[model samples]
Target: MTDIRIDIREKVFPAVGQAAAHAAIQDFHLTLHSGEFVCLVGPSGCGKTTLLNIVAGLDRDYRGEIRIGRQQALPKIGYIFQNPRLLPWRTVRQNIELVLQESSAGNTVDFLLEAMRLTRFQHVYPERLSLGMSRRVAIIRAFAIDPELLLMDEPFVSLDPPTARQVRELLLDLWRKRPHTVLFVTHDLREAIALADRLIFLSPSPMSVIGDIRVPIERHLRQDENEIEAFRRRLLDGAPHIKQLL
Candidate 1:
């Protein structure tokens, strides 16, 4: 188990010829304990994804220090993007196996498939699966690698309401089993309320942490509609500006 420390002093996107540059994050300091599920929310185009990219080490042109526990080596990171980025040609089981090839975790593909209720669809290709099912496979693939840190970028976005709720439940189940240190990005305040141990709110642009609200209710209580609504109100009251975006 490894804790994370992120101290991003500044991050800038340089101008491409005539296009003006933009500041994505500035003086953004955050920390995540092992097994903590943290959610990031803000107005659209506020560089939430940019912040995830930096933490995942995909974009390194920035002035900052990101340390993971005490390990000098880079942590193994798993990412679930907005779209289910599974290979179109590969079957669901094969997609998960691809990630497992490098991992020491044995027989994880089948276990995760069953856990996510994708066992019957293991042999199906990405195109054959529904949007929700594909996303489940995508999640299974991420966890198959047993990553030290998981970064999810609106994994349930754009789905129909019912389907989105189903996926959220499935995600919660899988998360409870492993409890990997997770940083999830989302635009939905309710979804953040349902999943996060702590909700981190960012400013509109030139992203910076404006509020960090801990979810008052326990994880189990989130399933209760009344509790969910109550917590939602608490969040809005604490960060009134968030209501404007919603």
Candidate 2:
């Protein structure tokens, strides 16, 4: 687990093609405590992905300060993108092992495969697997290395309700077993409430922090559909702005 402090003063995109130069993120500040699950919720086309990219060191052309731990050490990072991004040629187990070293890759792979219910498909190729299966493989691959900081960008989008629910449960199970600081970005308010310990809402274009809400439901009660719905209703009814943007 790792503590993360992010203070992005301004993140501007250079003019390209017909699009003019503009600020995607501005005056955004957040601190993720170790082993906490935080969700970023906002409108589509906002700077959610931009923020994740900055934190993951994918885009360095930005003015900000991102520190990990007390002395600012580089933390072990795991990223799950919108798509699975798995190697189609490799088997499910091989694709997961691709990110782990000899020291880190062992029973960890088998444990994750079994936890995610992918043991039967471990030898199967990515092309033969369904999208949900691919997503599960991508998830375990991220967990295989035992990352201290996990960054996810709307990883469960476009799936059917049943598939999405099952995947969410699997992800929660993995998270409970291996606690880590998670910075997850999602568009679904209910999903955010169900998964996140804290929720951060962003503005439309010049993305900035608009709301910070802590989920009030107990961890054990989060699985109940009625509890989730009731909590979501109370949260939305109390905050009109959050309801509008989310």
Candidate 3:
């Protein structure tokens, strides 16, 4: 088996200065292996993003341990937030290069620029690029670090249906080229099933694992209308409650 492993045990987080002290994750636990594409799905306000932040070492107020492999639980992580969050003043290429420079991996900028198909808009500032183009730059910036784990928090949430579909395909292509453990958080069941090897569902608030389903489809499968619809149906079957929302 691969040496890469992610283990989260009894994780919990409480919001501070709130009328009602809310628990974001109550005893949440999971294990992930290398090259696995895992998608986390849940209703709104389920603390999915909070859990991701903890794993990424952005939030340290949580209980329980997160271990990677047999080592001391430290793994380089790349985070993609809901919005592109690119600097308006910087061009597309400059924004990506900034992240690369931060990671001291400036040499990888050229490769990432081509891989993300942002070469054409390399000199275009964030304000000049379309929403989809900006998001693509963000994705490339995250991946440029060559992180062992990639945490994507609804990175395509703001795109239109067609644009989102294209981005999904592009992401899959990138995943194939560079295999890493990916934890993608999204509310869209279809997107989850279409991209992930395993789908994990969380309960409402104070989230806990409600369901775990393995998608048997191959990664090479084309994302056609029929395939997407079938995958969506399969995901709904795995989590019946999701049917009402769809």
User: By TM-score, who's the top model here?
Assistant: 2
TM-score of each: 0.95, 0.96, 0.89
Q: Which residue runs does candidate 3 get wrong by more than 4 Å?
A: 1-18, 101-107, 238-246
Off by over 4 Å in 2: none
RMSD of each: 1.6, 1.2, 2.6
Candidate 1 weakest lDDT stretch, 10 residues: 99-108
Residue 63, model 2, lDDT: 89
| Candidate 1's TM-score | 0.95
Which consecutive 10 residues in model 2 have the weakest lDDT in total? 68-77
Rank candidates by TM-score, best first: 2, 1, 3
Residues 101-138 of candidate 1 have per-residue lDDT tens digits of: 65654468778888899989989888888999989988
lDDT of the structure predicted as candidate 2: 0.90
Best by lDDT: 2
**Local distance difference test scores for all models:** 0.87, 0.90, 0.79
* Better-scoring candidate (lDDT), 2 or 3: 2
* Pairs in clash, predicted candidate 3: none
Point out the higher-scoring one by lDDT: 1 or 3.
1
